[model samples]
Target: MSDWPPHPEAAAVPSLSDLLERYATLRDTILSLENEKNELGELIKAALLRGERAETELYRSSVRVQKRLEYPLERFREVFGDAAALEAASIDRKKAEALARAGDLDPERLREIALVKEIQALVLTPKGS
Candidate 1:
């Protein structure tokens, strides 16, 4: 007898049922962990708001809150003229895409302006449910 156990060919290939079961298990695990994380985040936020800090063997955590100033576009435009508001604002993607489609602008120019990424996902559903 060899030191290593013999591998069965059947064990090498996973069935669709096995894959689906594993997928479901992982999905449930991810959802449960996400819920726990959200709950912890809310607790952290509450503690921080109450001027509390937490120090553990593994980590030290504190919150620093800051104020941000926001300008309402239409109201701002009404107050400061459209040209000035447009100069202050960032590029509008929809208008840029339209211009690119119309050949009024070079698509190559967008390489520096935007970073495009592709995403793929597998969606599983129960039969007739």
Candidate 2:
């Protein structure tokens, strides 16, 4: 084959004006894509910020509900006087003893114990950490 570049017509075909026009068109296309990329980046940033705010709000709401329940739980203990509390304890002891008497363990008592263990796990967790 002959030399690939610098054919005589190659230098003569595109005038300076035509080359400048092509450069301008490519520059405008690049700038438009840049603007679109910037807009998309800004949108992504705003969405991430909003998601963080929503997570914070959800945590705050959960704390509020937990705080609201505290008073009622205390009131329930107060309303059920000491005598009733002792009676309930006695009944529980009797039930436990009865379960021991039986050959098989009480599944209900086991379930209650498991539930209490789970609840205590939640209760002892440090706040805001």
What is candidate 2's TM-score against the reference? 0.31
lDDT of 1 by residue, 9-113 (tens): 445566788678777887999999999987886787677658876655555565545432334556545654666457546435555455557775555654344
Taken over the whole model, the C-alpha lDDT of each candidate is 0.56, 0.44
| Model 2 bad stretches (over 4 Å) | 1-12, 52-129
Local error of candidate 1 at 82, Å? Answer: 22
Q: What TM-score would each prediction reach against the true structure?
A: 0.43, 0.31
Model 1 misplacement above 4 A: 1-12, 65-129
lDDT at 99 for candidate 2?
A: 47
Whole-model alpha-carbon lDDT for candidate 2:
0.44
